[model samples]
Target: MSPRRIVSIYLPHFAIQRWRRRRFGPQTPSEPDPIVLAREGHHGPVIHGMNAAAVKLGIEHGARVTDMKTLVPHLQVEDAMLEADVRDLRMLSGWARRWCPWVRVDGKDGLLMDSAGADHLWGGEAAMLADIRQSFGKAGLTARAAVAPTIGAAWALARYSAEPQEICAEGEIAEALSLLPVAALRIDQDTITLLKRLGLKTIGALAAVPRASLARRFRHHLALDANPPKRLDLAMGAIPELLDAKLPDPPLRALRKLAEPIEDIDNYAQVLGVLLPDLAEQMDQRGLGARRLALTGFRVDGKTSTVEAATSTASRSTAHFAKLFESHLERLDCGFGFDAMMLEALVTEPLPQSQHSLSGKIEDGIDLPHLIDRLAARLSPEAVLRIVPQDSHIPERAERLIFAGSNTDAAWPAHTRLRPLRLLDRPEEAEVLYAVPEGPPAQMIWRRRTHRIVKSEGPERIAPEWWREKSQTRLRDYYRVEDSEGRRYWIYREGVPDDGRGGAPRWFVQGLDA
Candidate 1:
């Protein structure tokens, strides 16, 4: 075997750079700001939590927005978009696959590829590192590569040591990473700072101290040592694991349902609500958002149902999320009432937001959605439908009517959409008298109300769309007309005279009160 060349690729400046680009999205005025301060320091959009340019501008990871603003008076600070970041990380991971197949995404912003025999493809370790750097460089990414016997050492060297890429000979991981700071072990800030303050700064320093004392001083270090890839797989042994966990910048997840059955809809809702909200909060706490969610509802009756929906944008609001749940509730069947609902949100994306909540006037009203939910729960999801336009030429089928939650942005084409607020579920047949073929019904008796058409605008003929079975025998000449009461009516002739498709040339009141 050509040495197992485990490579760690890290993006030290991902969050900061992404924050800057989002803040400067296409339409910022020609302005001088803290970002300008970064530019002045010759920082080429490559700013990190600890880059000298960022430090000079006083931007620390845990620093407050007000303090950052004070540090760089013109600093254009931004809240992180964890959803977008995770998305980018996933894309980067797939892209990193070009480097090695045994690639495991590490934490939020790193990747570890088991290069092993693959390193020789680029001639050697040094050449491989160069190629990796060049590849990321072309993709507008700043990455640090390191090779080590163990994942931990490579993680430490890539992140902590600024020596670019560190390539260690096989089995030299402990020795190779010993000098790295305790922070290189990817511990929490308090632990790292505490270790440094206690003279336990480097990995070697921490390692040399009595294990009991070190464990006593920082219990987190012991816990970190015990962390594993899958949450269920807790680690054992003196596993000096990689300090970095490659988390996707884009979000995706798969979940399994539990054996227990959920009795109450509210109870079922409560567990999932608590779990999903808490998990999402953790993501938000980490500056992230989820754009898609999949819910797998398992019942005690050996039956399973799955519901999936994608958001037009990323979100974290519990209310907005409950709305997504409405889509799947019908299929859940409440079998033996549900045993469990395992929800997994994927296609995580960064939420687009401004600094403040746009500080606007608070609009007050009964939340119509809350009412809609109650109504939908009581009625057939399809019984009460909302009109949604499908992109097509057939008027009736041109728009689809679907359950009205999660999906509400249905727009109709203006040319064809002079639609009335109320349309009969099915057109109401009318007695019509027209002089010309396929012309407006001059006088029509609709719904027991006899009315004469004062004026008409269309013989706007719609030929039957042969592809659709329902529309195969239907042809209509739709007209928009106003009656004496100044009420507008949308009426259509179902069949034209002597047409091939056999049907009475019946008139119907399709829509009323445009």
Candidate 2:
């Protein structure tokens, strides 16, 4: 294999430049004074980063905001926006793919590109560096680019060089870095301080000292090898890093690149019709079924639109996927026209082969799952719910509605007593007439109409458990009564007469059996 030739691009004013361009467009009048980004720091708010203008004006980074204001009164200060800077940095990385495909972000403010085989394509290393710097200048950014046989040498040279572009010859890396500061070795600040105190400030000075003497005097940890040239040789790939330039794993996906752009909904449906079967086949081969699916439309103009759907169960059926995709296809934006369509199974579950019985009806007891899946796709998953019994005695609190199929163990409890077919969520007040102190009402006035009781049964008492809650609950005596017109009503009295717990007992209509 060919030796790795890494290029490091350092953007020193990344944050400040990003903020300034956002504030003062592309054109700045004259010099536009100077600007510094200030953020909350260990010693209160301080200058975190600065632009070239600030640096030229003798303003330094990490200076306190108050002191900087005193030093340069007209200095424009803005709150630091690190997140936006990182996003722009990533975009710049994507742009750098024009030169090389293997690029990685180096620290927060710099990028490393493995330009081993790609330099010749851009007309050698010098032309590539010039192009990179010119691209940043066009984007209102200042950049320093360097190419070396080693990433460490490239990183140090890019930051420390006076010129915007630098190249270190293949075997002369040690000679090139020997005159630079001890910090070029990427050692700790404490070690650099100790080295300076010992009169060894440059890489060459440290290299001249005996290995045993250097190790014995300062036991401080450093990235030093037996000799600087030997380290350079190793870094230059005489011995390789365990794994360098590792790319992220691609997601589980399937794609269909159309011969022509598709715009109409019917055409999209036809494409999906062809793609779903292959996607299901892929899932089946992996012994997996998708629980969540995402459909993305890559437009002709380099823009993409996406829509996602989740299933009630892990499914590998093309019919199931087709139904789901059809339901949400209208929401996808077909900008220009779609050049390609991709369907990715974002979440999946292991599904083993199923055994079939030779019964007359293959799907015997529960096709309800398929029905639920259809409804959930047509509407929202949240819109379809299953009712399950909660452990409570109060009729309103006896059951709760939950997302369908979430709990496999959910079931309706068997009835201990007859409950009305229809129940008011909260009981409605009724005026009881001829209600004896301890007996059921003979008649009641509800909705401004009087109903005479023809027959009655039940004084089944239900009281609230006071330990679990602190609500205004009273003893309830429920009765199933049939009116004179033969309509059955579930009525209850809230309190006992003369029990003195609260006040006069009142009647409420809780449910209806008619």
Candidate 3:
């Protein structure tokens, strides 16, 4: 049986590196100017992290911002988002799963992978480490990697080794670690200081000391890192440490390697026809359905073109999915023609099977999801929309436009009064002649036209939402009135006359009734 192997990936400057890639594009130039990340400290702002440039200038972490400003007048400072850094680190670890399945986050800025049987896939351990570093470099990250027979040894070597990519051969863990500093044991700084004071600075020197003497010195310590013997034992493989690997859900995807490169849209459609059914069969087996799907064509020149489609509801129907992609296949630029095709279900939901009608009759009503998918494919997704009622009393906030497929079943609030068929984007100011100060308008001039009120029905008063609006905000009184030509208008008064919120009440045309 082969011995267990572990790989440690250390990201020394994760925070600032991530900030630079996001602020500037991934192709950011290496400027010599120092950059530091600052966070709010109890004593005002302090340096949380720094880039390679700032490190060269001796600006260490936890330095006061005021002091650093005095030292380097041209230093660039950015607010540190530590929480976002941790999140992106987890995502980066997940992305590393392409190399090995058993991968987990080691600390705030490191990852540990059980690369026991996976190293052969990349030829050998050294080649795999090189590939890992090159991949991270391409993704705008500086990574150092090491592989050893134990997790502790790999962790120590990845961080403390002189070389960026190091591999410890089998049965050489102790010899490799003997020359490293006592800090490499992952112990506390106080223990390291004490060990150095006792003339035991190296792991080899510490190993020469009696275990009984070391235990007597650290017996009163409670923290995990305070025990150097346990850490040394773990690193030397005398004690066992298990890695808590992150296992992601299996993705629903199907791929086909083509025999020859084909650029025709019909050929692409044929490939998609086969891919969709395979995905549908996988979805059926799991009693699931896809809400979003992506079709990607890998070209001979090493580039890829992808077209995506989304449905109003979960569906596993191959015909429906194929129809959605059919119109989009023409949009793919084949370059040197596609050498492979892949179909992936990016989003899915549980969908149980339903019985079909025994009469063999066509189902009543429109297939709304299929229709929406087709329309969204033809026109842009933003071109199709559905207006859903919002939970607000303000007329303008009463309803909002969302993509057509979402919130299809949301119920509108029941109202005793009728609303207009069409509402204007914004209310237009109008001059009104009222019979009474608070009564509905008898005549009004709007949009440079006069309308004589023949019939009128409302004084529907709606108050501003106090929690969301300022206390000084005025209330509104909406009226539904019809002119002599039978054309109706929805008009509102901004405030009651002399109510003290503002000047005399102002009238405006809110919408046009059908």
Candidate 4:
């Protein structure tokens, strides 16, 4: 069970070390230019990545910002902060969970983790890759790491080895993946262009071909097994079956660490109300509850401020997460003063424990979930909404609004006619006036006002899910009419009654029945 190390890291100048720490901050400017990030492509701003002085001036990575400014005419470019490089790769995956709690990220500039059994608590695997490259060289960042026992041989020794850390031994993932390339078996680019037009270019030439013609010429099933103990147990570890289809990260977090640097926001709301009663007693001993939480403070000058809060269901209430962090604690930017706070539930559920009604009340409708958690903590979770039910028989695609306290049990569609209590968020193109395009319209103008119909019933037709979509729409009919100032509309007509598509069926109105 303990034989699966995995590290990987690799940042390859994650967007020029985040554009040289946002234009030189944690210092390093002795010779700067030659940057490049560009992005708008379709044949315009291409060069999506560069630096190491635009790769020593060859400037090639989908190169183009108009031919790299006609070949490094002092390059520099910029434009690709890629959402601040994915918010500094999720704050370096929350600072690599202080070293391994199975981190993963790995793409838009790598990070993989699973330092199995946690790299001997930071001392071996080359002293946890020299203390994670000295904490990414004090965060100006430029990591390269590799430790292997297979996350595809530590992502092929962290981007094909030049050793900023390498460690593979344990039947050496097929002699450290036989000198690399076959894109190190992370496969597909059409299997590395059909293994480079079949000269099988390395994973030791697809381990010398023939494992039933490498699974009938690349119908691949991991590491071309030409038998070296079945390609060393199918090439050591091509992502431990993608870390067993992911989802292990959240351990419901809490952290605190203050002792001093607090800068009163009521001492950060008295340390988040004494850390929400031990995070609501760890979500009430795991019957779980939280539905998105976050808090994170970390400040004393190295910036970190998160506040997040969302809920409509799962709730292990600590005065409902201190009224969901008192509506974003006055937008926390405690800058030079936080010294760590943390929280993190980031979504949880299962909350089971609610049977009490011998006249104590609560068969659902508890003050409308505390007035929708105080209007989603003072307005904004898409400003509150929530309809749900949508399999679509098209009454505006049969319901779905979502966002106000989400956790839907659904159940609302049972119409034997009469639906309009207030729908319209779109649907108001009326004008009709007809004398018989199949009866009932008698005066409709709407919004520019004309209405007369004094009482009409409906055509109520609907149709159009045509298995959800490929576009054809038209068949509607509906009508509930009632005008001459008695209001009540709901309209609809669209088409059908001579469905030969096109001309005169239009109408629309959709809702209003007070």
| Top model number, lDDT | 3
Which is the better candidate, 2 or 3, if ranked by lDDT? Answer: 3
TM-score rank order: 3, 2, 1, 4
| Candidate 1, lDDT over the whole model | 0.65
Off by over 4 Å in 3: 1-5, 12-91, 94-103, 114-148, 156-233, 242-275, 285-288, 292-309, 325-367, 378-380, 389-394, 407-419, 435-440, 453-477, 480-488, 495-505
Q: Residue 481 of candidate 4: its Cα lDDT?
A: 81
lDDT of 2 by residue, 276-347 (tens): 787788888878888888989999999999988777778787777788788788888988899999989999
Question: In terms of TM-score, which candidate is stronger, 1 or 4?
Answer: 1
TM-score on alpha carbons, each prediction = 0.44, 0.54, 0.60, 0.31
Evaluated with TM-score, which candidate comes out highest?
3
Off by over 4 Å in 4: 1-8, 11-39, 42-107, 111-370, 374-399, 403-435, 438-471, 475-480, 483-489, 496-514
Name the lDDT value of residue 252 in candidate 1: 41
- Model 3, 372-456: lDDT tens digits are 8889888977998989988898989988898888846778888878999989999999999999899878999988999999888
- In model 2, pairs of residues that clash are none
Candidates arranged by lDDT, highest first = 3, 2, 4, 1
Please report, as a residue range, the 10-residue window in candidate 2 with the lowest summed lDDT. 225-234
User: Per-residue lDDT for 164-274 in model 1, tens only?
Assistant: 888888656657666777667756676656666777667766666675664455444346543211111111114544433343344344344555666555665666666
Q: How many angstroms is residue 498 displaced in model 4 relative to the true structure, after the best TM-score fit?
A: 4.8
lDDT of 4 by residue, 1-514 (tens): 8877778888877777777678777676534577788889887889878777677778887767988798667777878888888888877776787887778687788888777887778777899888898888788777889887777678777888767778887776777778778665565466577567867677876776666766564343545432232333345653234453244444887889987788667888888888888888878877888878888888888889888887777777788778767868878888779988988797797887666598977667655776787797787767788778886677776777788777677787677777789978889887888686667888988788787887888787777666655565677888888888788888888875667666667888978992
Number of clashes in every candidate structure?
28, 0, 0, 2
